[model samples]
Target: MSDWKLFTDAACTEEFGGTLTTVHKTNFSDNPQDFVLYFANVAGDPGDNQVLELVEATQPGTNYLTMSIVDANVGSGHEADEITLATTAAGLDTAIAGASLDLGQDDDSIGVIRLLSGVSAAQEIHVRVENAVPNEGTSTELSSAMVEAISRTKSTA
Candidate 1:
């Protein structure tokens, strides 16, 4: 729908990341396999905001470098502004679709993104959005958004 920005605080204020908002984290713990993230859209047509991919920054592409997106949700709640999102994204028996998520809303988790296993070592993973055009030219990498320095201990059991 529109370009987005990143924020450290839950209120969505104090914008961090780059001008277009980049989510970069170094030394990411591997204990929590399920990682949570929020979403919001700006007022410009950037690209198709359909799916998200996890790849190593060193190997920037859909190569299954280090991480994986187990699952995702539209969002439980969102904010109209950079304030507290007092309202929930769903009401009654409405089904929330991740494909048609409201990018206009404030940062809110999609849902249940789990990782199979940690990387081989301390590696940087780049989380980027893509336009799923189904073998069409419409597909493209949406943003330079990324997360880096993810670390975890490989169990030797």
Candidate 2:
């Protein structure tokens, strides 16, 4: 699969329940060239009010990266949810300048983004749940599991 794997954060508190996970190559192999980041809601009780964040370990200047997420779930709750991986509002807007993203629908959804070369290979990439209001438990588990699975796939591939 892929060399990347999930490394759980032990510093997360109840305010940030569950672990914030990062996916990276096992050995941080020769500057990851081409790869598409994918995330899906695999197993969890469906609900609304769920949000996920994609974060990258970054330095002041050297590295920059941008990507957008598109939900792939089917049916009503499967409405396309797109989010750009940016730390600033301006950056996010720039990243999704021409993309059409819908935030409507229940919390049960999956999204994926294509990683570009601007992102630093030395940085760790991951997703963070912003508000786990309605489905905190299930969201935490499912999201973590989804990331874990994807990282495993990359590692094994």
Q: What is the C-alpha lDDT profile of model 1 across 1-157, one tens digit per residue?
A: 1233343344333444432232323233221121123332222213333233222344333122221222222231211111111113322114222222211111125322212221111112212222221222221122222243222221122
| Candidate 1, position 109, lDDT | 50
Off by over 4 Å in 2: 6-70, 87-90, 97-121, 124-157
Put down candidate 2 lDDT per residue, 6-121, tens digits, no spaces. Answer: 22222211122333333334354432122223222211112211222122224211122232344434232212221233333334434442233221112122323212111122
Error of 1 at 157 (Å): 57
Q: How many backbone clashes does candidate 2 have?
A: 13
What TM value does model 2 have? 0.24
Residue pairs in steric clash, candidate 1?
38-108, 39-108, 41-103, 73-110, 73-111
* C-alpha-based local distance difference test score of model 2: 0.25
Q: Give the best candidate by TM-score.
A: 2
CA lDDT of each prediction against the hidden true structure: 0.25, 0.25
Error of 2 at 45 (Å): 36
